[model samples]
Target: MNTRPPAARQIVIGVVLLVVVAMIAFLGSLASMPHTDGWYAVAAKVDWSPPNSVFGPAWSILYFLIAVAGWMIWRNGWRENQPNAAQKTLTIYTVQLALNAIWTPIFFAGYPLIGEPAWWIALVVIIALILCVIWLAVSAWKWSKPASLLMIPYVLWLVFASSLNAGVIALN
Candidate 1:
């Protein structure tokens, strides 16, 4: 038998796992973005563009903050008498993550890469929804400040990504 609160160490571990998964997903998505396509959009094929360099470090830091967000969610789950709030918030989280996961393959690894950018628009929707829910949860005291704060990078990235996607649609 074990004796531990529902929001005990398991929540922390889960948060860490979420962060690791976020980093891997971010890296994977990079493999398919515009600059990585090897078409030399702005420079030599092998050259490092500003976006790629900026993205790498920014995403690394984002991953750390995201983990903290997960922890906050877990703590919130513990405080609730039932799983209602946790389930809803986590469902939104899962939806966003799933959308995030699919973006790379569509934009980068898709067979023809023709319809890939549309997927990015969809990703934008997911990100927007996620931000809304996170804001609600934080405001309602269902989640911690750290969790909301951690997601700031993700929100920022999505805003940038939405613009990039539009540019891609226009250019390509």
Candidate 2:
């Protein structure tokens, strides 16, 4: 909005926005959690798979990074002269977040309900997510280097997660 509130007020807005994004991501995770212990507990996994204990903290950190990254890019895009760019960036952010929110349920809930087809669907969803993440980073890099850099950890985590999904498919 660049209505240019005082710097302190602007910072408050940024903080609130980031917190809201992170909270939304966290809430989405809750949806997938109920689906986990069912089939996921018994699902075969790769030897390299980290313990179940690792996911919560890892995702928590990644969600914060993603939130800040999104805010940085969106903030940059919203400059007075850049409304069109802001719209495009917002679209990228929405698509990736939508994909992220759905993936776990597809992989975790879908398997128990639909069998192997669920994993396949999850795989497709993840690949799309990875693409969207890359798109977000590229767009972010153009607007803010810090924003793009924040995505690196997310990329690494998603790659590891993708392999885990693939491993389960092969093992089961």
lDDT of candidate 2 over 93-143, digit per residue (tens): 779888988888788777768899999899999989999998988877877
Write candidate 1's Cα lDDT for 28-104 as tens digits.
66655653656425323222224565756776676566555655565566543444356566666555555556555
Q: Where does candidate 1 stray beyond 4 Å?
A: 1-8, 19-23, 26-37, 40-49, 79-85, 111-141
lDDT by candidate, in order shown:
0.56, 0.80
Q: What's each prediction's TM-score? A: 0.66, 0.86
Task: Give the per-residue Cα lDDT of candidate 1 at 152.
Answer: 66
**Residue-level error in angstroms, candidate 2, position 22:** 3.5
Which TM-score value belongs to model 1?
A: 0.66
Per-prediction tally of clashes: 0, 0
Model 2 alpha-carbon drift over 4 Å, by segment: 1-16, 81-84
